[model samples]
Target: MKQTDFVEVKQMQVKCVLCDQIEDIDDDALQAKRLRNRKLNMYLCTPCNERIAKNTKKRHKSGNFHLFKEKKDTNDYL
Candidate 1:
């Protein structure tokens, strides 16, 4: 096998879970590596991620969005 064959095989085709858009990413890229290693981090195309971020910001401006954060226990330091 030639080096080109390895390169071609290393290229990964991923689909965005939100928009179903297909994108080719280098297997050695950090995003590709994360996707391959982690099950929870699903792929999202640039557009979908941007749209979601925009909506989240709009919700925040409405003053009704609440983020539940875990309260740190001060007793843990004892």
Candidate 2:
């Protein structure tokens, strides 16, 4: 007679929005929890996230970056 047992592992598969890279995340991880709670749907791999940050800093230093403020129409009858 013999006894065998196996434990199952939990993994969440996520795709990177920028490079479309497929990666697995531990189900108990905070990022996975956020996704499960629908806080954010987009996922970016480490490389893509870093690249964007680097480029944004360069653009900001070059004075070519701009953030447009939203215009709101005020009620004319005041």
Candidate 3:
């Protein structure tokens, strides 16, 4: 990529974990900071987030939205 003249501020490049879309976000944003600090933090685009929210709402209204929790192994240490 060629360096443009209006390249003063730095942009944080992030990829959506689900959609794999590359986007540029403000480096000073809170989300960017969280992503940089946490390894498990995932970044989702606006459309993907909206779609998940809509589907979750629909499932909740249907009374079949069950959040399955992971089974933790019990420790045997005395």
Candidate 4:
């Protein structure tokens, strides 16, 4: 095909910040688009994500887990 078509169809290469694994994602996928536009959303491979979820569940079961939630200002109406 044409050079422009080839450029548009190219895959995006991204590295997982947590596991340092390089992965190729489709250029048109939603994840790819989010990563391209948002700086705070990092890529995590499936394995790493699953492992983290498992560990979080385990911690929750131990009755000592705490999640820090940001407090909203109470004086905003003043």
The top-ranked prediction according to TM-score is: 2
Model 3 spans with C-alpha error above 4 angstroms: 1-7, 60-78
The C-alpha RMSD in Å for every predicted model, in order, reads 6.3, 6.9, 9.0, 7.0
Weakest ten-residue segment in model 1 by summed lDDT = 65-74
For candidate 2, lDDT tens digit of each residue in 1-74? 33434545689999999999998988888888998899978888889989988998998766542332112223
| Cα shift from native, residue 78, model 2 (Å) | 26
Q: Model 1: clashing residue pairs?
A: none
Off by over 4 Å in 4: 1-8, 56-78
lDDT of 3 by residue, 1-78 (tens): 557866767789989988999989999888898998995399988799899899988987665423322112223332
Native-structure RMSD, model 1: 6.3
Q: After superposition, how far is residue 59 of candidate 3 from its true place, in Å?
A: 3.9
Model 1, which residues run further than 4 Å from truth? 1-9, 60-78
Candidate 1, 58: how far from true, in Å? 3.3
Candidates in order have lDDT scores of 0.78, 0.79, 0.78, 0.76
By summed lDDT, which 10 consecutive residues of candidate 4 come out lowest? 65-74
- lDDT tens readout by residue for model 1, 2-77: 9876665477888999889999988888889999889537988888989999998898766442332212333454
User: After aligning candidate 1 to the native by TM-score, how far in Å is the CA of 37 from where it should be?
Assistant: 1.0
